[model samples]
Target: MKISRRFAGLAALLVAGLLGTTVHIVTTAESADAAQTSLRAADPSVLRVGGTYVGVQSVGDNGIAVRQASSPAGLATAAARTVFTDSQRLGEVWAPEIHYDGGRYYIYFTMGAGANHRMYVISSATADSGYGGATKLNLPDDRWAIDGTMFVFNGQRYFVWSGWAGTTNVEQNLYIAKMTSPTTATGSRAVISQPRESWERVVGNPFINEAPEAIKDPNGQLHVTYSANGSWSEQYCIADLRLRAGGDPMYVWDWYKSNGCLFGSNRSTMMAGWDPTLYVNGPGHHSFVLLNGDINTSPPAGSSFPLMFHAVAKGTPYAWSNRYWYTGSFMWWGAITYSRANVPGSTTNTGYSIKFFE
Candidate 1:
């Protein structure tokens, strides 16, 4: 990847470990100020959801300024919009998920450039609109990374994100570390899993494997799923990392796959899936809600319940390029599906459902 002093100078890590490893923390008053100011300058009331995706286009040089969308899906389709954008005129927003906890709405998303991406959080009064500005999380490295997802387990919050080990783009590992506070880090980072398997390492330039999302199984076990391969080539794919209930998410763990491409097309066969986000619209990132009703609370005999997830993608699954940007590449928003066919009901799963407050 291209390197610039401006980018390298942004790293902040103290007391490097034995393996030339360190956790980069860049939480500063200035960055925090920028986030708050962004929220105050913009009219938070303007953002609302359209039918398919959230609709809030940027004015003039701004890109998609107010993104509001309607949610027919169970997740309360609250109105949302961008409270701020940097002077660079490039808006890097992806898969904005709102989680309601302890009577608060936490907005989580990935922000930053190619390899130097970081995850940030902002709070809001409600699940949809009136969101506060983002406070940058102090992650290990400040390099090419994005797609940081948040999950609450057993009353505690944990963060999962994709990061690179070195300047070389050969490896992208999924990491899980405990947050000391709701938005800060405390414990040592763990390399939960890497793209060592053949299915994960796609054949292409800028080889990568990242974008991890995790959900607890009915048995209280953790099933962490992430995408593998190049974002621009056909090697993009998705896989799962598994950990038992008592196991730590920070340690290296073995994962399971669906035995095939969770979602892909006839382009490069494997490397086509990017940014696999999961939500409970009834289905998941791989499945959509065909009908609305009282879902069967119990699994059937000799079989697992088929729970669906609601999701949105930065790009299409099988296509080599994107359509909207028209640059032979780009990311868009949409949905996908995954079936909890074999997972038991008591596994601590998110219930293939969503709860939102308007």
Candidate 2:
């Protein structure tokens, strides 16, 4: 019954190839209930414009598939259309994120057939059209990089990504640098996070901490969420690091890791309503977006921030094909408690809760 992690990934891929379908069967009503509670599935990176929502997913050889709709419900049913493709990039394009800045939309993605992965960017005039050719992002060094995302803080634009410390592939860490422009880096890169914690060092790989996504809470504190562990294992999960409002982002000492993972595989049996078989598996590689309004009205209002990340079915083979989008709102109570309610611009003493679909 002992299976090697490498073999497990291979076996999952082989099964996927033979089955010719990505969907897995749910054997029980409890599993079905879990699926229903989960967000609509996709390999999603989502953005909302006015009333319309747009998303992009990794499509292997066909390139990044873009989907759009007026509502999240409609977006679930919308057919994907190929938006950006480079015949020269002879491999998979991974984790494409769409962002709007300076009167244009930009997409940051990872592309490579194998070990030589690098972060690339493309520009578009609108939210979902006129995308320009891809260009390699100007990093401080040209080692290996991926999962690049951008954010603005204190009126300065910055880019954050997962990259190798050197030419070697032994370790992957999260780095941030000031951006001279949307597609270029201006200064030295800061190594924000590495796989230093036991929880971050998953079984298959001791050196991982990739897929960085940035979010600014209402209090103006900066939070960066990144995926940890081997991407191919059920242990893959999301963790967070935080910086206070006036903290220096370039200073490594200014940021603090969350007490524990923000989301991931579950082993606990405390929840009476949760079937252990239906627990979320490998939930990481995520992006965050704020909803225009509350989706739940029963509590008068709910948090608008929802996390879009990929997860696999419990007990399923850990193949890339098995990864599907699942989103849930974040509970800020843990963050507040961890920060001792010192989060900026907050006058309340209440904790926040995530509103999952019923």
Candidate 3:
């Protein structure tokens, strides 16, 4: 099994402080348009130092609830809003991966329906405003799906998630779908990885593989990671696929599971935690935030927020235990790094810059 993982270099983190430095913009197609509402930026900042955040129970039994610190150095504050609270129709919304691209913010998350959950897209002219209604993509064959993450490789975008090859639900496989747009997918959902492998299997409910997150290294290698086994004792694992410049991303996503678990259950450099989460454990399902501070500053902006789920203490390194949190809840941001470092094959040389539209 091939896995592509990168470790970043030790560099200073910078916080932007110039006026006009902050911008909020959102644009979308007409038919799917919903009311536009302004989102509030929590004071003190939720992603603070030594703070804790916990996911709020559903107010009306719908949508994910998130809370965090107000300042980079303060106590966590709480807040909630229904992004997609139509339980009778959409059911529970989970794991929202927020992205900022092309002057707009696109939030990709899993929405539940009846016994199955599929991925959907919501947009806001601004990163932290009330997003318009969602557009659900018809996942190939309508297999039970969840944990949808949007990724861009070599200038092209793709969606990766967990689903069953057939309807049995006994085997949840990792699949990728090509995107015609942020809200729609073209072509069939291709199977990238399956739980049948010895390293991918687990024992319990939802018994299978799920939740895939992919990122590229400075050398342009693609690293995809996901969680397997039952949710209660969930395990986080990673694998790799390579994409050459101008190569079809779909073809580049060939499946090959990693050698072992990156972090989960009893194995990991980081302590094992349920949800087998990532991207800075916060208010939602396995999420990660990339705050690309100025290349010359220290402790970059958007660096802290409250803890989530279990309400543990914050202030540890961003990659500390499963208890840190952040409050931006929603906001517009940008990163300016040319390539990712610490990835496998440090000797390989390749570089590219990424500018996402949510």
Candidate 4:
């Protein structure tokens, strides 16, 4: 992996202000429409520190677009500068996540045209530039895989993702493996989550559990939130799996599945009653980021952690092409609470009683 020295200074500056600074922005009715227009259907991942951010947008082999923003809200306005396109493998790229570890920035994503899907990694010296070549991660089994992300717990790094349980795509399950390095897996992979719940299984397709994203709460508890139901169904949504502190990530029995969907279709009274002006549907396939502060500047508050996902417009047909980027804030119970109204400073009320910025 190529390491860049420029990031060392920026990283230090970021760490110093990460927990102390709050970002505030005011949105008008027009700004909401602008936000919706900027949204995209792919898995959106962003790394934000103070006013600087690096976001990953999956736009195929032309290489993923790595955009830079001055502030968290500015992400929608920043122009993208493409990277890693020249080195991508023969197929398309999907779900790219950017991480900074050990003085280098690593990008993990899924690649391949069809049933040949697999996870690949590339490195850069800085968060926004100098991307190196791509390398396939070493998985014990070579079944279909996608939406790979990494998290560190107890000082050990682990890779988690959704993959086919067998050669056929009859079923998809969430898996984890310890990492020997940023681009290599060690030992056997453990099946952490599968589609056993009735809501998890789609009518025409195999059971699904994909788009795994790891989040650590204020109490230091570890949780992996994944998308369930079929991606094509309006019922497609997000769910959670919790791991005890210092527990074995490689053991399926060590993770506990939360009750019900954390975020899904219109199950809440607020969502079911949404007005046409404030409607969003099929909210899933998400990643989380901690915005420095609430979007409004008047109320100086602590960090605002929100889930970034894609949703279809209120009256649009449910299709991948119709999905666009949207964000919703969840109250931190022992797990995430997504069914409630807007929290004080973190979320704004959309018509559906969903506290998300559409």
Top candidate (lDDT): 4
- Superposed model 4: Cα runs more than 4 Å off: 1-37, 86-89, 268-278, 290-301, 335-358
Query: Tens digits of per-residue lDDT for model 1 on 1-358?
Result: 4322122223312212323433222112211111111111111111112123222222333322433333322112334345545455334655344444445556555665555456777765554466556677887655555556666666566877777766556666777778766677766667776565555454445455455555543345555555556655444444555564465566553333333334433233332333222210011121111111111111112221122222222344433222111000011111212223344333222111111100
Specify the poorest-scoring 10-residue window by lDDT in model 2: 23-32
Ranking by lDDT: 4, 2, 3, 1
For model 4, what is the alpha-carbon lDDT of residue 127? 68
List, residue by residue over 258-332, the lDDT tens digit for candidate 3: 344434333442211112323322122232323311111111233221111211222333221333333222112
Cα lDDT of candidate 2 equals 0.63
Model 2 steric clash pairs: none
lDDT comparing candidate 3 with the true structure: 0.42
**Candidates 2 and 4, the one with greater lDDT:** 4
lDDT of 2 at 162: 88
Clashing pairs in 4: 4-125, 23-293, 25-295, 270-352
lDDT of candidate 4 over 1-358, digit per residue (tens): 3222223223433543564422122121222232343655567787655567667787755477777776445666688777778353568888888776666778888888778888989888776678877888888798789999887766788889889878888888999999978888998888998888655664337778998877654445567888888888777777777665555777766566654565665463122212122456677776566432111121123434444577787789988888887644443432232222222221221110122333
Q: Candidate 2 lDDT, tens digit per residue, 1-358? A: 4333234334544654675524221111111122212334434677766667777776656387677876443455677777788678657788888876766778888888556788888888776678878898888877688888887777788898888888777778999999978888887999888787666764544478888877654455677778887888877767677775577888766676654455666433111111122356777776565432111111112323344567786777877767667644443322233232343443232222111221
What lDDT is obtained when candidate 4 is compared to the true structure? 0.64
